[model samples]
Target: MLKKVRTVLDDVLDIERILGKISQDKANPRDIIGLNESLKCIPKLKELLHLEDIKKLNSAADSFADTAPVVELISEKLNEEVPAQLQQGHVFREGINKELDELRKLASGGKQWIAEMQESEREKTGISKLKVGFNKVFGYYLEISKIHQDKVPETYIRKQTLVNAERYITAELKEYEEKILSAEEDIMAIESELFAECCQKILDRADLIQINAKLLNRLDVLTTFAHLAIQKKYCKPALVSDAVLDIKDGRHPVVENLLPASDRFVGNDLKMNVDKSQIHLITGPNMAGKSTYLRQVGLIVLMAQVGCYVPAKKATIGMVDRLFTRVGASDNLAGGESTFLVEMIEAANILNNATAQSLILLDEIGRGTATFDGLSLAWAITEYLHNHKAVAARTLFATHYHELTELEHTLERLQNHHAAVKEFGDQIVFLKKIMPGPGDKSYGIHVARMAGLPGSIISRAKDILNHHLEESMDQSGTSISPEASKQLSMFEQQEAKFKKDLDEVDVDSMTPIQALQKLDELKKKHGL
Candidate 1:
């Protein structure tokens, strides 16, 4: 459809200046030619629009007033081959104006008249080689060889003397020059007047042409988006009044398009409502697609809202009054703000302005600062977005702070989701699939190794990580309250005793019944 439209409208020239000229009544044959070229396609495009079932598209096409009259008048009056500049004549039809037709005949026939005179003079003077010539200094002259100087007619007035010939103009020749020049001047003046009259006919219907022009632009965009949807296999999202956003098999359109043909993007699902899953606390390691998932949801919502098909298998969007996204990081050095400062400013704006009807997308908030500080900020922000009534917006928060996932048990509206990963020895593969539940580890060191970090650096980092793990688990990435200290000590003692007993059990000598009895005793002891 788009290809047919482009082929049909290929003759339509840019009529921006023509439109301006029509308003001022200063349009020339060239501008009218451009205007006619554009308006003539209206009927053809209208025929194409009839093939579409969309009511808006058909109505816009139907709004085109009968512009055939304007196109006909311009086509009839303007010559098939018209000069771009208005002052050059031969722009109008011969019979349109009597005076213009007469002057045109005189101007056009001047060359033949000059040729006849050259032949007549050569015969009368017996100068067989005489030729007619013209130049800026001498308007028109008969050039006679010096050998025929004696035969030159007394009626000839000398104009110029060349090395090989003598240039002379007769009285008839001088008089004809003035008349032909006057005819050309009159021809240009009449053409300008005639061109203006034709332009006036179009200006009378300017409003209708402007309406059709706007309609064509609207149709062009619609058809292009239609083509894009068909090629990309997009779905028409179902927009509703409630505050629920459910998308199935959603993929990021841009990422999908940019991926190499051999690789396929993994699709993910998202469901959000004010009820149970308003805020999704997404956790995963670096290089996972948590940020991509956040942006994909934002883009899908925006696309659906703007009447474009969303890149998903199915989508049901509850119209959001406001959508806020802060997905990536960049420092505005000229503005004297670091990346973390900018992140905070954006977070502040979302916190202060977002409503229950808004959709918020945030990625790796507070990740630029110290780990504990960043984790604390991330945790509190999630709690605020979930608990505050004014800011209880549907949100997708992607972060690497795994400790924040504990909020799933605390906040009713916040759900824990992570980009799933698979591990094999020291290497891990990012599945790029968002799944329910908290991620066990960030795999920061594993990601660093994958990034081509030095082996020594990776080994030292792992050593430091193990040292931190052995020191005290609670004090590492998450804080424990003083109130839970006794509970932690008792649990730690129970684990120690359970390990000691499990070590003492000799599997080689124990029978199946003995093993069952030993596990029951250990469970009771561990409970104590």
Candidate 2:
């Protein structure tokens, strides 16, 4: 099937290029030839479309009108041995116009006359330096040098004087010059008019020709898609008009091609729906295929919508109205916006415009700010996306913030999934596979060691991480050490002082504006 498609494409002429020539202000003979050649291919292409594998191509080709008459007229009228330039003549056929043919013959014979005159004058004057010259400004002239000036003839009428020579014209030379120039000019004018008439004839059927050109272009693209499908082993995805998207053993089309044969791509299954799972919160360590999984789903859905087969074992895609991706971080520093600000702006655009049928891919949504602030924003955004009544867009949210994994328990349509990894003592292997549930831990130190960071820095980072985790557990009502108890006591004292100051405010006798001023003073005094 692919071979047959390629054979048809080989016979297809670039009809668009021909149309471009026909639409030019001054269509040349080469343009006519190009149009004739393209028109001849229409019949062959139409015949090839009869194959069973090319039903779409046949439908498009059937609409094309037979332009054989136009091709015949151009081929018969225009000369096959035309020059690249139109001004050099020989553009029209010999029998197209009698007067133009006669003019060309006269122009050809007159060139011999000029050459013969050059020799005849040299012998008659007995001055070997005497010559005949022609230019646009001076039609024709006989020249004699200063050394031979005494040999000048009486019938030579002085036309002009040169620094070292004299120029003269004869009555015979003037008569021939007029006839040759007039005939050449008339021949060019007649050929141009005849070519213009041919162009107008082609333009008269321009609408039909344009229709055929457009259909041929469509056929070419469809044939190309068929070829790619066969070469890549892509399957036709089942497209449905529902809210469910299911794909079994889906692979990233571009990544698979770029990988070496030894490192085969690991395909993953994806299933999402508006009611069951609208948002999949992905948590994993860096470079663990989280982003690749998100992008693969988006690409598969897009490919299916374009009427092309998708790179998947078995796939079914529902109609998606709009697709939005906020995968990477970028800053508009020149525009006075930080990375976080740009992130928020894009998030706002997605939230405000997305519909229930939209597909959204968000990667590390809030990683530009402080830890608690970023975690809080990511948590809130996930909740809003899952629970928003008007916009329940199917979302794949990839984040390094593990705190987001907690949302799965609270949000009904939100599910937790992570890229699987294998652990070996202190070292870990990235499986590059998606699985159920949140990741057990983020092996940042292992990743840093793999990146070749200094051992001392890695050691210090591990110490700091352990300390923070311990402090977090102590603050959450776990057994506290003496130093943590001291910090907790200080916090208690500050809270007590704030409450006392609030209780002392006398709002009953104060004006509303005065009460605001008094509250502001108290807040500053207590460091609230």
Candidate 3:
């Protein structure tokens, strides 16, 4: 029944858009016609739904309204061929009003009126060659041959003198021409009044029409979802009351659709539980589908609750009351607070509002601030979510801060996942696949190299990284502390500043004594 209904409803117009255009006092002919046509589609739906074969399904037909009266009223008055605007005047059936019909006839028959005037004037003047002519330059004129110039009356004003004839405009011709020209305005005035009256009749039943519009919209959305589910090979998700979100081979709906015909989006699997695996700590490098993985799980859960098929091989979702996301950097409009402040504010909102039933997706949560501050906040937020039951929502957190992955052993409910990457010497490829366990490396410099950075900058960055690693890590590189990393980072910053100052010294411009004094100042500042 729904398949048949979906096809018939293809003709249903956008009644909601049409209703928005209706004026309080004016009847927009175009909008009214749209409303009428949309309502007319209800009968087809009613016929399909009012089936006795299934007897119990008859209740669905009761949802529709009897919009026939509105449809009939609009059809009776609206012209088959409408003008672009009401003032242009063909918006109604010709015989709907007597005055309107008379005005239309007068407006359309101006040529016949002018032809009769020429005959009457020829009889009156006895100029056999006299003719009534009209143009933009000399409107409604009497064109007489130069031979009959003597017969031109004092009442006739010579508007133009031609090569072999004279054009004259008389008071009578001007008076009759004004009537003919004003006939169109009169016709429009009548049509406007009639159109307003007809619109009022329909507006009196606006409530019923609006109700039907909503029902039809619901029907349309369900049918579209049905068609897409079949076309995209989506699966119906199972709903559970407990705290678990399990999806197998789930794909991102938007990214999948946007890929080329030859390319297929790689599907990933996710399973979470409030008691065992409430939080999946995602660690991956840039552009390796971490964000896409986070968004897909959240979207699939949402789709299941919203009564639609999800893009997954199989899904069993715990209903989510609130879905909170802190995915990217954004600044406040006032500019008083920094972007990091904005990130904290959003994080605060999610933390304060989210409950055990909520779903939270945090992508690179601490990337907006200093590394120490960011890592601290990311670590503490994860602990707060795990320790506090009130806010212990199912979370999918993606970050480049690999240190946070160490929390899986500390937090009982936290699990580790990464977007897998493959490296060949200096080159790395984002495999676009999610896999279990924490990532081996962030590959930041490698990602920068892939982004087309200059070779010199890339080489310098690698040198700085290696220097930091050597200074901060243990000899085996198996035991590294954040405290040592912070100290080494400060030392690196100070060293770079001293190097910049030494490189900027002007030996050619400085006197010997002043150069000695500058060297003493640098030695004192650097504790040399």
Scored by lDDT, the top model is 3
lDDT of each: 0.84, 0.84, 0.85
What is the Å distance of residue 173 in model 1 from its true position? 14
Clashing pairs in 3: none
As for model 1, its CA RMSD to the true structure in angstroms is 13.2
User: Taking the tens digit of each residue's C-alpha lDDT, what string does model 1 give over 305-397?
Assistant: 988998899999999999998878888899999999999999999998999899999998997789898889998999898888988989999
Task: Give the alpha carbon lDDT tens digit for every residue of 364-417 in model 3.
Answer: 887788999999999999999999999999999999899999998899899999
- The whole-model C-alpha lDDT of candidate 1 against the native structure comes to 0.84
Candidate order by lDDT, highest to lowest?
Answer: 3, 1, 2
After best superposition, candidate 1 residue 77: deviation in angstroms? 5.6
* Most accurate candidate by TM-score: 3
Better of 2 and 3 by lDDT: 3
| Candidate 3 segments exceeding 4 Å error | 1-4, 23-27, 50-57, 115-153, 158-168, 474-528
